[model samples]
Target chain A: SQQGEEDPQALSIQEGENATMNCSYKTSINNLQWYRQNSGRGLVHLILIRSNEREKHSGRLRVTLDTSKKSSSLLITASRAADTASYFCATEGETSGSRLTFGEGTQLTVNP
Target chain B: EPEVTQTPSHQVTQMGQEVILRCVPISNHLYFYWYRQILGQKVEFLVSFYNNEISEKSEIFDDQFSVERPDGSNFTLKIRSTKLEDSAMYFCASNRLARGYEQYFGPGTRLTVT
Candidate 1:
């Protein structure tokens, strides 16, 4: 299974602080994406970093991918209470045809 | 902004019964997919559909699970027989040909098999 695995199962941070979550996968990938799920609902796509790209940013969210290490990290800067949600990292396998495999997500809580 | 949409947000059925989850992907999207997540578990890929046929499927998409695009707009996943373990949140997703790697997911249907 070329599943991505997220580290730090849970985290709690005060509003305005930064929260970082890491993900590691076993195989090469075409692209890595970050998603946010609120209250166990459907996932909302946040950012996508292609294999050639090392870093990508959208608003307060930044994602860094290191293919050499088969790892990726998502950083939420100046997190507000609205940023509190489970963050997931999904990978589109290099050999697979556009199938996104998700990892166990990191539950983030922002205290206001 | 168009996104994937699914019908029957929640379903409760008895074990061994048949249930079909319906989805209508974004109008212009071509690729479609079905995925499920058991509670507290990672989201798992079930199947991917393209050109009116299945292109890829995971181990979890067994004989009991099947997907179909009956027309140009609707995509469906049918469970021939629901097992107690099949209870999970099922998500439908789709993407356009230009952006095949970036999928937009539906709200999902929560299946509770008794």
Candidate 2:
């Protein structure tokens, strides 16, 4: 299993606070993607950072990747109640084409 | 603002019965994929299709499971004999191309096998 593992399985924060989740993998990857799932709905693509890239940002979401450590982190700033959901980090292995192995995910709860 | 779409949002069937989950990927997308989540478990990749052929498949995709693009606009996943363990949320996703960065996912079909 080339899947990554996310740390801090669960998190809780107040509306205006920040939430940070970390993921660590064992193999070399071509790219890593972050997705958000709201309750029972499908996953929404949040961000993607390539192996060569160190940091990327999209609106309130910031992602950082460290190839040396084979780890990545997702930071959500000023979270809202609506941001409560599961966040997963998926890795595209160097040999896999369009195939993604997803982590267990981090359950986030933001209270307003 | 195109998105992937799936039919039969929820289906309940008895064990050993066959079920087909349908999905219409974003038009113009060249790569399609199927994934499933077993309730609280993490999402797992089942297979990926491209250029009218299967590009890759995981160990989970076995003889009991198959995928087809029976028409120009529809992609289907067929479970020949669904077991109680098959109960899960199946998601369909597609990207503009294999090199495309982001993948758009469908709302998913919830399968409940009794």
Candidate 3:
């Protein structure tokens, strides 16, 4: 299994607070992506960080990657109720192709 | 913005029956993939198709499973013999040829095998 493992399987935060989720994988990867899924819906791509890059940002989402540690973290700043969703970290294997291996995911809940 | 679309958001079938899940990937995209989530489990990759051939597949994509792009617009996953354990939410995804890293997923088909 090339899948990653996300820490803090679940998280809850106030609307104005920040929420952080971490993922650790065992294999080398070309790129890591973060996705959000609202209840029963398809995943929405949030951000992508390449192995050559350490960090990337999109809107209020901040993603940091540490290839040496084989770990990545996603931070949602000033989270809103709408930010409550299941977050997954997917990795593109170093070999080739667009296939992705996904983590167990972190279920986040932001209270308004 | 274009996105992948799946048909029959929900399908119910009995064990031993065959099921076909359909998807229409974003037009102009060159790569297509199938993934499934068994309720609370992690998303598992099934297979990937490119250039009209299977580019890659996981162990889960065994003899019971097969994929085809029968037409120019539709991609399909066929389960030869559905089992109760086959119940899952199947997602279809596509990525542009120029950007293979970012994939767009369809809403998914909730397959219920009883």
Best by DockQ: 2
Tell me the tens digit of each residue's lDDT in model 1 across A9-109: 99999999999999999998999989999986888999989999999999999999999999999999999999999999999988888999899999999
In candidate 3, the residue pairs with backbone N, CA or C atoms under 3 Å apart (3 or more residues apart, or in different chains) clash, namely none
- lDDT for model 1 comes to 0.92
- Report the number of clashing residue pairs per model: 0, 0, 0
lDDT of 1 by residue, B1-114 (tens): 898889899999999999999999999988999999999888999999999889999999999999999988999999999999999999999988723368889999999999
Model 2 Cα lDDT, one tens digit per residue, A1-112:
6577998899999999999999999998999999999999999999999999999999999999999999999999999999999999999888878788899999999999
Candidate 2 stretches greater than 4 Å from native: none
C-alpha lDDT (0 to 100) for residue B7 of candidate 1: 85
DockQ of each: 0.65, 0.78, 0.70
Residues B1-114, candidate 3: write the lDDT tens digits.
898999889999999999999999999998999999999998988999998899889889999999999999999999999999999999999998623369889999999999
How much is B51 displaced in model 3, in angstroms? 1.4
DockQ of 1: 0.65
Error of 2 at B91 (Å): 0.6
Q: Rate the local accuracy (lDDT) of all candidates.
A: 0.92, 0.93, 0.92
Model 1: residues with Cα > 4 Å off, grouped in runs: B98-100
